[model samples]
Each structure stands twice: as C-alpha cells, then as structure tokens.
Target: MSKATVYFGIILLLAVVIYFSLGSNFHNSTTSDLNFGTFSMKIPRYWKKIEFDGIDSYIGGITNETDSLTFDYGWYSYNLSYENREKQLFATDTINGKIALITKPKEVGNGTLGIYIEEAYKKNRFNFLGKNILDEQIVFEIFKSIRFKDSDTTLNSKSFGFTDKITPYSGRSLFYTHCASCHHRNKNLFGPAFASINELDFKKWIIDTTNLGLTGMAKFGIRYHQKAFKKLLMDNDIEKLIEYSKVST
Candidate 1:
C-alpha cells in the first residue's frame, strides 16, 4: 500500500476509537434525580451541581464545562407591565404539558445565549444558561423532561433541616419568594442585607420603609400592593418575618 494510504488508515482507526470511547463514557455516566419540592428532573452525570442559599421554593443549577441550566421558583402575581425589555419573544410552545413562552435576545454575540422559558403557571422561571452551547432543540428536550411532582411529596422547611427558631415557615417562603432575589440574609444584591437595619421597632419600620420610597428603593407597598405587599404586610405574616430575621441575622 502507498505511504499516504497507510497514514489515512491509521488516522481513521484513531478517530473511530475516540468516537466509541466518548460514546461509552456518556452512556456509562450516572445521572442524578433532583426533587425540587414542586417538580423533579434528571440531570446528566457530566453536569456539576451548584449550591444555592435562602429559602426559595426551589433553586438549583447544574453546569457542564461549557453549558448550564438554572431554575428558580417563587410566587409573584403576574403583571404585564413589569416584563423584561431586553428579551424578545422567540416562540410559544407547550412544554411538559404547560404553556411556555420562549424568549431570546436579539443579540447573542457575547459568548452567552440564554433561552428563557416562562410557563403560564406564574410562579416559576426556568433559565437555560450557556454560550451558544445548547441549541433550541436541546433546550426544548430538557424542558419537556421536567416532571411536576406530587404536592404531597414536596420538600418543606423541615426537609431543609431548619431549627425551631425559623418557625412559621410560611414567612420564610414569603421572604424567599419576594425578598430573596434582591436581598440576601447577610449580603446585598440589589438592596441592602436584612441584617443592616437597626431599628428599635423594626416591624413598624419595615412596614413604613417598604411602603414609603427612599433614595434608591421604590415604595414596594404601593408598587407590589396587589401583587405581594398586601399579603406580606398582614400583621401575622410581618411578625413571622421579623422573628425569622432576628434569628437568621
């Protein structure tokens, strides 16, 4: 055989070996089943799980070397006025037996291309995180794989191993749903941490401050009154939240 033909045969053998090795690796990797209170999903073994803090209904992220997917669940009254501007609607489709609105940005040249899926359920948002790594078809497949778990089997405050000090778990849920995105227990995101407030009558101060706008903070009482403030401002709810804050801080 010619020298060139011999070299080609050797290269083809190496390529076939590499392909089968990769395929075998993928097939042998173990997958993890995640139960996120409201739902459950299977994650590929190659993805690394990222830990999240706070008492969100469900919060989790799984990342591969070049791709990731993160999901968060919270209760927010739907408001058409508060929709994001940077994202443009890409398509609407049924995913996991629920109506989903898929959106993407007009520009995706920054190495990151996010495809957001908003379900009509009004409480959960699933973000497919990657940099042109996961195509639309793959995202849809992942979305379809999501399975809503039975409410009875959902994880609760006790499952998280919280002590009695963080009782009235509803308040923790409320804080997580409404406040956690912007505020952390000890650190700050869009707003100051809950620990920074040093009010003698913190409950009343919380009510007043949240109701009245100050500096960079909008009057949440007015803005989210119908959506969340009314429920959060209830005497019992506020009391529970204050108690939780005291112990958590």
Candidate 2:
C-alpha cells in the first residue's frame, strides 16, 4: 500500500493495455489463420474473401471501399481451387495482373507467394492497415500444400485465399522497429544485416539467439515468439525482410 507501488501498478496496467491494443497483430485483422504449408499462421477475425474475375489485372478502385480490400481467393486445377477461402499475402500488382512464378518446391521456409499488389493509381507499397481502396491490396498465387478440408485424405492440402492483412511491412519500417536496436541500415551492430546471413539460418538464429544468445549479443529480438506477431508473419516476411535489406544496403 505505498504510493510508489500504486504508480508502478498503473504503469504496468497501461503497458499491458498497449501491448494488447496496438502490439497484438490481431488487433485489426479478419481471418481464421494463414496456412504455411502444414503450419498455421493465425489471422484476425471478421475478414472476408476477394473474388477475382479470371482476369490478370484489376482497375477502377476508389479510396473509400473498405469492402474492396477483401477479395475472393481461389485456385483452379491450375489456379482456381479455393473460390472462397481467405488468407494474407505480400505482393505487387499491375494494371494487367499478378506476378508469382513458383519455380522451386514450396516449403515452410523461403516460400514466396509472388503476386502484384494494385492500389488506387498504382501505389505499390506497404501501408500497414489496408488504406483507401486499392492503395492497400494484397493478392498472390497459391502455395501448394495439403489441407484437411480440401484433400481426399489428410496427408496434405493446399490452402488458397485472399486476406484483409494483405500488405507486408515496409523495409524502412522493419529496420526501425525490428532491427534498429541491434542493427544498422548498412553495417551489423549486434549480429549482421540482411546481407550478412543466409536465409536458412536467419530464422534459426533469431530463435536460438534469443534462447541461447549466439555470439556476443544476447537475445534481443522484438518479435520472435510473440503470440500475435508470430501468428501473423510468415517466412515470406523474412524474404521481404531480405528484399528490404538489399534496398537499404
């Protein structure tokens, strides 16, 4: 019952509220969960699906349609299977169409659902929350995986869909929030930059470094095992991160 103790309690309560309100990746999302191969990346609630018209390109988007941000997700025998499912995507779009050419096999790591993100007047960049109309669109090709609902057997299922949390984080934003503490834009501070490490060990280093503290630096990550961020971000985030680094470096 001391004054100092009471103030500390209030501060702790505010911190928790901010963490839940702003920090949670599900704060303003709308989906069940994104599927990374067999792994599940939880999506927010209340989000719907996007419906494409079999055309490669999209046009005539205004800056007021919140509903337009959500699109119908489907994949046929070649690319139109899930005419209803919903999911998140990191992509780029043109007036013509998407651009995902999966050359390598799809795995839990390093899987890119290449797609073009079209916006109002072609603003191809990450805008955090889905801004006005196409200014914040996220569309992509399907990752071939096994699903319990789609496949005849439970062996595997390839989930396909669009997402409300479609836009990926910008490189500049990622650097400030995620890497600024221990890393710089050009050189490595605690560990290394995007150009320093390989893709395979990047995630592992993030986990083990936080757990065991590899090298001289201790575990200083912002979102390695966060319940919200972990559920929201896919390996593609890392790839986007790498792409971000190339620009910075």
Candidate 3:
C-alpha cells in the first residue's frame, strides 16, 4: 500500500474512535446528580428543584415539563382500592435491600404514574412521579442510581432536620419523619389531634414528654416517641414543629 493511503486509513480509524468516545459523553452529559444532603439521584439537567406544599408540603421535589421526583426522610403511605388496583400495572422490588413500588397506568402513555420507595433500614423514603412518561426503563434507571450517604454525619450537621433555618416546609418533613406515624393534625390517630393542644403545654410536651407537665392521654406519646423528644431536636426545632402542627391540617 502507498504511504499516503496508509496515513489516510490511520486517520480514519482515529476519527471513528473519537466520534464514539464523544457520543458516549454526550449521552451522559444530559443528566446530572442532584444532592439532597442525605441522598443523591441522577436527573436530567432540565429538571428544576421546587418545594411541595399542603400535606406533602415538607417534601423536596424537582420537575421538568413532564416528570417530577419528590423525596424526604420519613414515612409515606400509598393505598389503592381493589378495583382500581386491577386497572393499574404495579410491581414491588427492592433497592439496596429496601422495598420499592413502581406503578403505572394499565396502558402505556396513559394516566398518572409513580414509584414509591420505603427505605426501612435507613428511616428514609423517596418517590418519583411522571405524567405520560413513555419510557419506564429510563425512570427505573434514574431510581436505581439513587445513592444514600453512608453516614449520619451530614444529616445531623446540615439543615436536613428542623433547625434554626426551619420553615413550614422543613417542619412538614420533620412531622412526617417523627410524628405522622402516631399523630394527625385534625382527627385522632394513635395520639390526640394537634388542634386540641394549646401553645404552652404543647412546647412542654415536646421538650420533655416524660415530665410532670404532661397528663392524661398526652403522656402516652412519651413511651412511643422518646427519641423525638430526646434526639437531635433543639429548642427552635421544637418550636418550629409546634408552628407546623398548628397549620398542618
């Protein structure tokens, strides 16, 4: 072969290699990892973070034109009646040993759909929702890439919990994390309605549930939620939680 032909062939091979390498990066460049102090997840760069309101008001969420992902460190409950259950396609699986549920409308390109994850081992939960998201595999890949920070140091040190920076938003997360399992804002659950408590005694109840300041059924909360009163909460955190409870309903 002529040297000129040999040079041209080598250059052509290098061009092919470079093209493939750049193509791989271009695909990856469309997504980036979003950090939320305790965990991180891969999402499209076009997705913008927003705070949710109302009952889910404490949740930190992100969304684009068609898809949304919301998550928080706490308990989340989802229920569907038997008839409606038959109308949907749903499956349960595990993520890092934690149970997860992915639900979609019966037919593709149909109704609302979501993924609910219960991270029992870590006392945290997260979920994603999309409307008419034609590609379930793409959403699954995003959920699969979620990475939880290996330690609690960041959760404790940062604004992850109720703190001086507490807002109605963060307070809702705190309530869901610690209080929602037992207490409800309006009607009674395992505990009395938050609406019944006056401000002064409510502060006392949160600060020292085992103390003499509490009486009757209110004291019952202590045995079930000792860690809430004892662990990680500051005076301001308690105050913020109290503020949230009043407006929570």
| lDDT score for residue 158 of model 1 | 22
Off by over 4 Å in 1: 1-32, 77-87, 107-137, 150-249
TM-score computed on alpha carbons, candidate 1: 0.38
lDDT against true structure, model 2: 0.36
Q: Alpha-carbon error at 24 in model 1, in Å?
A: 7.2
The sequence of per-residue lDDT tens digits that candidate 3 reaches over residues 17-92 is 9999999999889988887666677877887777655374236777776766555545553422221454466654
For candidate 1, what is the lDDT? Answer: 0.50
CA shift at 179, candidate 3, in angstroms? 30
By lDDT, the better pick of 1 and 3 is 3
* Deviating ranges (above 4 Å) for candidate 3: 1-3, 27-30, 53-57, 71-83, 119-125, 149-249
What ranking emerges by lDDT with the best candidate at the front?
Answer: 3, 1, 2
**Could you arrange the candidates by TM-score from highest to lowest?**
3, 1, 2
Clash number for each model: 0, 31, 0
Worst 10 residues of 1 by lDDT: 155-164
Model 2 bad stretches (over 4 Å): 1-168, 206-232
lDDT of 2 by residue, 98-211 (tens): 222121112222222332222212222111122122222132111221121222222211222234333324444333435445666577777466566665565654433344
